[model samples]
Target: MPFELEVCIDNIESLSTAIAAGATRIELCSSLALGGLTPSFGFMQQAAKQSTVPIYAMIRPRQGDFLFSPQEFDLMLADINAAQEAGLSGIVIGALTASGEIDTKNCRNLIKAALGMGVTFHRAFDLCKEPTTALEEIINLGCERILTSGLAPTAEAGSEVLKQLNELAKGRISLMAGAGVNQSNVKGIIQQSGITEVHLSGKGFRNSLMTFNSSNAKMGADEVDDSQIPVTQHQAVANVKAVLDSLS
Candidate 1:
């Protein structure tokens, strides 16, 4: 079977670029630098309207950690509902307990809220204290897929554990290799991780549109300042697809 490539998009430009470049699936988000925050309703609406491929909007309320407060959890469920109402194909959602295990209670609630829409348990899987045990519980929760880098910073580096998880998954759920995936390493990642679905941003940095010396101060919480914004490259997306196709 041909491997599935799920492009991670954060804006209308990336959305158009990915769609035009023949992406069949996309993970729609807002601040991908913050590990993907929930997108605005208007953004979701526009993406759904313009997209020909399946778009799964991220359900994260904020950046920081997978551990969420009660209020934050509530917000996540509300966001899931809104994304579904916006006609998105799926929702990427995940949360962890303080002890570093899947918050089955909250996660199941989110899944229940999703109902007919597809559900992907995000990279929070990498933060679990007991990953193997967590996998069985996640499978029991009926998530459509799990996006992981095998508890490593990158899928290529985590290929060993990624392959192990795929074996344990045993077709009960899909294991999508993600994080630091690029054209040069995509082929090796697929061969070693044994994953059918791969997730990446297909993005490159662009200088701020401002010609003026905009702001000497930064606004973003992390090191990802606005000076260089991530924009998807149509050729990058196409190259990933082309490389994957060549392997098949």
Candidate 2:
């Protein structure tokens, strides 16, 4: 199969950059520092208007654990409906039990709700107590792919487990390595894990255009510089795509 690079982006600017830089797919979300949350319906609609590649809206209701409350599940269902209405191509989603097992029932419902759209089970797969078991469950749930770091903090660190998962998958489902992926290490991760697909934000920070700053105005976290906005760098995305193309 041909290799694919899926770029994750949190804003319109980054969405444009990723596509210009050769992303085969786009994972649209909000609050990347919070590990990505479901984007607003307006953002989804605008992205659909701008993006050339297939855009998969992240279906996460919050930033914490994937064990969602019933209310949160209802919110996710609503978000899925909104994504469909916005003309998105698919959704990236995941759910787990408190004990670290795949929440099969909830996931099945999500897949059913997302019916015609392509489904990618997100990184909550990394938290599973049993990777192989979770892999089977995800495939049975009809997820077309699993985006994971192989239970480690980064794809490079988890390359071994990623390789094992790839071998076990045996083409049953696509295994896409993500988390801390960059141009420097992407080639190695793909080589070691034997996965044809990869995901990354290719993120970089830029100073806000505002020339004035008020010391008392702190709407976000105390440490974060609200003036500095996160953007997906076109060069960063291009470099990784070049590396993938260079590989046999």
Candidate 3:
């Protein structure tokens, strides 16, 4: 089987780059620096129009913890509706209980909202109290795949646990290793973890086009730096895709 390369993108430029570079899937989001918030409805619609491969809209409601209030859950359901209306092929979603287990009830509701579209449990899996228990819960929740880093900071760092998780999954669902994945370490991650699918941003920094400078003024949060924009590089994605194709 051909290995799947899912590119996580936060902007139209990166979206076009990933597609042009041979990405098999796209995870649409915004503010990837904050770990990816839900993309705007317009963004989703534009991505659906541009992507030939499947596009999965990230359904995260906010930037903080996965534990969400009832209102937040309602917002997620609305986002799912927007994804469907936008003609997206899938949705990436995850929610956790206060105690760190998968929020099965809310997750089921989200899954039900997604209905005909594909569903992937996002990296919130890494935040669970127990990896093994979380795996079973995710499989039971009916997600088509789980985007995880084996409960570690990066896929390369967690290859061993990823291998264990892959073995335990037994084809019940796909385990797509993500987090800090790049062209350099992607091959090793696939070999060590035995995962057929991988996720990455393939991002590289570029200075903004604006010639004017405002050193004292800022448009975002205190920590935000608008000088350099993070955009997915065609060469970066193509490099990883080449590796996957070679293994195929």
Candidate 4:
């Protein structure tokens, strides 16, 4: 079977780029620089309308940590509801306790709230003190998939852990290798981790042009700062094709 590639997108433009680039699936998000945040309702609706592939909305409320407060958890629940109503194909989320263990109760509640929608436990799996225990908790919560980097900073560093997790999963849940995954190392990650599903952004950085208004200038200096600008370069379909070729 062909390995599956799920691209992580930060906006409508990125979504369009991912689809054009031949990504089979997408994980919709915002603030890619600070990890990711939940995309707005309108953004979700627009993405669903524009893409043919399944888009899984990221449910993270903030960028700090996986641990959430009661209020933050409530916010997450509300976002999930909004995303589901907006016709998202799935959700990417996970929660942990103060002690860095899976918050089974909170996770269960989130799973229940996402009924009829696909659920993927996010990288919080790597934050748990014990992955084996966390995997069991996640499986029991009925998460359809778990995106991980084998508890390491990158897939290459976590390949061994990923392999172990894959073995322990035993079809109970999908182990999607992510974090620093790319064409150069995707094949090695798959071969070592034995994971069928993989995640990547396939993005590069581009400089954005700065616009300045002479009329609004003060002290003869341009009102808008143009010294530095960087933007994400959405991968082309050929990038996806390259990864697919490596898998074959």
Number of the top-ranking candidate, with TM-score as the measure: 2
Q: Where is model 3 more than 4 Å wrong at Cα? A: none
TM-score between candidate 1 and the true structure:
0.93
Task: Name the better of 1 and 4 by lDDT.
Answer: 1
Error of 4 at 69 (Å): 1.0
lDDT of 4 at 114: 88
Candidate 3, poorest ten consecutive residues by summed lDDT: 216-225
Cα lDDT listed for each candidate: 0.89, 0.94, 0.93, 0.84
- In model 2, how large is the Cα lDDT of residue 216? 84
Alpha carbon lDDT of residue 228, candidate 3? 85
TM-score of predicted model 4? 0.89
Predictions ranked by lDDT, top down?
2, 3, 1, 4
For model 3, residues 1-248, the per-residue Cα lDDT tens digits are 58999999999989889988989999999989899999999999998998889999999999999999999999999999999999999999999999999999999999999987999999999999988999998999888999999999999999899999999999999999999888789889989999999999988888999999889888888887889888999999999999899889
lDDT tens per residue, model 1, 50-164: 8989999999999988999999988988888888888999999889999999999999999999978999999999999999999999999999999999999998999889999
- 232, model 1: CA deviation in Å? 0.7
Candidate 2 lDDT, tens digit per residue, 47-97? 999888999999999989999999999999999999999999999999999
TM-score of each: 0.93, 0.98, 0.96, 0.89
Clash pairs (backbone) in predicted model 3: none
Give one digit per residue, the lDDT tens place, for model 4 in 47-70.
988889998999999998899999
